[model samples]
Target: MKHRRLEVFLEFLFFGLVMGITEDLIALKFATGEPLTWKIILIVFLVALPFAIIGELIVDRVRWWRKIRRTFQKHVSSVKSSRK
Candidate 1:
């Protein structure tokens, strides 16, 4: 169980590292016209590392999203009922 969690985390970390570098490099190229540098790569890595974990958490955890959707649905139903 523990090993599975670690494996998933590492997977996301690797995914984030690759995705972040690609997206950041493209953005930097078009947005700033700045040349790629070690500093920029390091910065992208730093930003993406935490986001990878966060993305995993957000995607993995659907309970909160379901709750929010239910609440919204209830609210819309109530509004419709009131109108009718």
Candidate 2:
């Protein structure tokens, strides 16, 4: 369980990092026409952190819910077929 949680966290962090960098690059291109700086990168990462965490949580929950639904459906189908 702990390992799975860590994996999820890392996955989310990577997702956030990629999103932040992309957005920062686009914004910089339009706003300042400047190359990436360490400061800008840090700022983007910081700003994206919360959004990433929230998105990760939501995604995890949805995945869990889907798994449960699939399991329930499979069980019900099995039972129905057995009865028939």
Candidate 3:
């Protein structure tokens, strides 16, 4: 469970890094008044906004969700062994 949480966290970190660089490119192209790249970057960055929020929400919930999953797994394992 802890491992799963860590994995999720790492995924979010990677996503954030990618988005950050994309956003930077958007800013750079916009500042330079490049038409094609600017429009593409702008659209992508705008689309990424909702995903960023969802990522943050997932990151926030991972800890609690992991704990709950671990507890449930442990309980099930104990019950099975006891029955055997």
Candidate 4:
């Protein structure tokens, strides 16, 4: 269980870091045409820190996802039954 959590954490962290750097680079470049520097890269990492935490805590929760899926399925089945 703990190993699963660690795997998810590392996965999210890597994705967040990659996406953060790419997004910030494009936005900053187009918005200001500023050159990429070590400072900017560091800032991007800082901004993505919270995203990593959120992914680990909220996105990785299987129980919450399952609840959401169940609710959606119920709603869909009800709609189908009404149409029949």
For lDDT, the strongest prediction is 4
Residue-by-residue lDDT tens digits, candidate 1, 2-79: 999889778877887789778978988899988989999899878877777777777656787898899999999999
- For model 4, where is the 10-residue window of minimal lDDT? 48-57
Task: Give lDDT tens digits, candidate 2, residues 1-84.
Answer: 999988878887787768877886788778998888888888887887777777677755778889899999999999999999
Clashes of each: 0, 0, 0, 0
Off by over 4 Å in 1: 1-6
Model 4 lDDT vs. the true structure? 0.85
TM-score of each: 0.71, 0.54, 0.42, 0.64
Q: Which stretches of candidate 3 lie over 4 Å from their true place?
A: 1-36, 60-62, 71-79
lDDT of 4 by residue, 28-67 (tens): 8999988989999888878877877787678878888999
Ranking by TM-score: 1, 4, 2, 3
The TM-score between candidate 1 and the true structure equals: 0.71
Question: CA lDDT, every prediction?
Answer: 0.84, 0.82, 0.74, 0.85
